[model samples]
Target chain A: DAGVTQSPTHLIKTRGQHVTLRCSPISGHKSVSWYQQVLGQGPQFIFQYYEKEERGRGNFPDRFSARQFPNYSSELNVNALLLGDSALYLCASSQGRTQYFGPGTRLLVL
Target chain B: GQQVMQIPQYQHVQEGEDFTTYCNSSTTLSNIQWYKQRPGGHPVFLIQLVKSGEVKKQKRLTFQFGEAKKNSSLHITATQTTDVGTYFCAGHGDNNDMRFGAGTRLTVKP
Candidate 1:
């Protein structure tokens, strides 16, 4: 079976620009979560959506937002990007338990 | 917001040596999950611990969750070249948010 899929494997943008990363969860999965992983560090949770509703959020700022589609796909949008935003954006899909991750989008803000 | 702390930040070991990483949570967790990510790769699920004081073994890897649900550990026996990666511990709090610790990067030297 296919696992979670993320789009735009790599992206580059200037400071203050906006970026959007997409993710398609595995078939039959209903939960999608976003995470940010800086170089040499683990991923930090950003947002989680289940059944098209925001179920959880991390310590990130309002500039970070996400949505879940009816098909259990997800999109992570970051506005007013800063240099510190350079990191890998990961998407994870889960059912009752066990979260499967996508390859992630590497976003670099110059 | 919940916090998961892991240590030490990095480890280097001989190919045949053993290694261990510990994870601690600021608050009690409902479940703890472990993931491994190779350099420049995505985090992959390795195992999950739910019950208090639970222990699970997979091949040469052993996972343990503390009785208080506030800590966890991953131990590897006879590390191999394939074991070179970052190990992360994620904790799911009562609010359903999963927080990941700053992972421990492991390097195996042949």
Candidate 2:
């Protein structure tokens, strides 16, 4: 079975612009979570959705938001992007407690 | 909010040497997970510990969870060049909110 998959392997955006990244969870998975990873740092949790419901949220700002679809796919959106927002966005899918990550979408903001 | 801290920030060891990384959380965790991320690549889940004082081993790697569920450790024995990468520890709290440590980057000298 294929692992978690993400779209737009890379992206470039300008300050004040908005961007959206997509993720498709593994088959039979009902939980999707979003994380942002800065250079030389580990990933920071953004949002987690289980069974299409917002189960948890992290310390991210209002500019970041995410949602899960019925099919367990997820989308992460960043508004009014800043240079600090440049990082790799990762999506993970979980069945119980163990999570599988995607290749991630590298976002560069100028 | 939960905080996970890892150290030492980086490690460099000769081939066949042993290496270890520690992770501590500000709050007790429901579970702790280990992941490895290669340079310019996404994270891959290694293992998860749900019970306190749990110990699991995979090949040359051993993972341990503290009795309090507030700390964890990952150790590699007789490391190889292929072990070069960042190791991250992620913790999940009672609400299922996850937090990741800054990661310990390992450089193996062949």
Candidate 3:
């Protein structure tokens, strides 16, 4: 089966702008999670959705929000983006403990 | 707050040498997972260990979950240039929340 997929492989935005990143889970997967990875750092969890409900959230600010669709696709939105938001936004899908990650959306905030 | 930490933030070894990275949790974990991310790439799942004192192997890679469920380790019998990447360990808490460590960056010289 195909792996998790993400959209807008690359994006550039200015501070204060808002941006949305999308993700499509692997076949038959029902949970999707979002993470942010700054250069040279490990991925930090952002949010997790299962069955279209918010299952978990990380230490990220309220400006970071996410939702899952009925089909298991997900979207991550960052409002009032700051230069600190420049990083690779990763999406993962899982059935239980094992998660598969997508290629990630690279965002650059200037 | 839950925290996961990895040791030897960086390692450089010759292709034929052995390498090992460790992950420790501030509290007992329900489960832990390992991932690898090559430079300029997103994370990819390597394995998940849900049972204490469990040891799993894949090729030359061996993963071990501590008997106390508070620590884990990944050891490569013989390093290869292709093994160069950042290795991360993620812990899952009671709420199914995931926390990732800082990761150990590996550099192999062939």
Candidate 4:
């Protein structure tokens, strides 16, 4: 089966702009989580949704938000972005167990 | 609270040399997972160790979980150039929110 998929493999945006990244989980997966990985650092969790509900959130600020659809797809939104927000945003799906990650959206904020 | 940490930020090995990376947690973890991310590529899940003191092997790679459930290790025997990548160990606590370590970058030179 196809693995988790993300959209806009790469993008460039200026500071203070808004960006949205999309992810489609693997077949039969119910939970979707978001993570941000800066250069030379491990990924940091941002949010997690299960069954269209916010199950958990990380240490990110209010500028970042995410929502999962009933179909299990997810979108991550960043408003008034900053240069520090430039990173690889990863999406992962799981069934209350091991998580499978997507290819990720590489966002570069200039 | 950052829970997971990996030692030796980077490791360089001659092809056919052995290499190892360590992960430690400040608190006990219910399960731990490993992933490998090639340069400019997305992370790919390698293995998951659930039980304490569990040991699993795949080809030249061996993974071990400590009895305290607060440490883990990955060792590669006779490494090949294909093994070049960053190895990350992530831990899931009781709430299922995953926290990842900084990762150990491995370079295998021919």
Candidate 2 clashing pairs, residues 3+ apart or interchain: none
Candidate 1 lDDT, tens digit per residue, A1-110?
88889999999999999999999999999999999999988888898899999998888999999998888888999999999999999999999768999999999999
Better of 3 and 4 by DockQ: 3
Q: Could you give candidate 3's per-residue lDDT for residues A1-110 as a string of tens digits? A: 89999999999999999999999999999999999999988899899999999999888999999999999999999999999999999999999878999999999999
> In model 4 chain B, which range of ten residues has the least summed lDDT?
B91-100
**In model 4, what are the clashing residue pairs, if there are any?**
none
Best by DockQ: 1
**Residue runs of model 1 more than 4 Å from their true location after superposition:** none
**Tens digits of lDDT, candidate 4, A1-110:** 99999999999999999999999999999999999999999999999999999888888899999999989999999999999999999999997668899999999999
List per-candidate RMSD values in Å: 1.1, 1.0, 0.9, 1.1
Q: Give candidate 2 regions above 4 Å deviation.
A: none
**Rank list by DockQ:** 1, 2, 3, 4
lDDT of 2 by residue, B1-110 (tens): 67899999999999999999999999988889999999999999999998999999999999999999999999999999999999999998655677889999999999
Docking class of predicted structure 4: medium
Q: Write the per-residue lDDT of candidate 1 for residues B1-110, one digit (tens) a residue.
A: 57899999999999999999999998989899999999999999999999999999999999999999999999999999999999999988656778889999999999
Model 2, position A52: C-alpha lDDT score: 87
| DockQ for each model | 0.86, 0.84, 0.82, 0.72
lDDT of residue B75 for candidate 4: 96
DockQ of model 1 vs. true complex: 0.86
List the pairs of residues colliding in candidate 1: none
iRMS (Å) per candidate? 0.9, 1.0, 1.0, 1.2
Question: Stretches of candidate 3 above 4 Å error?
Answer: none
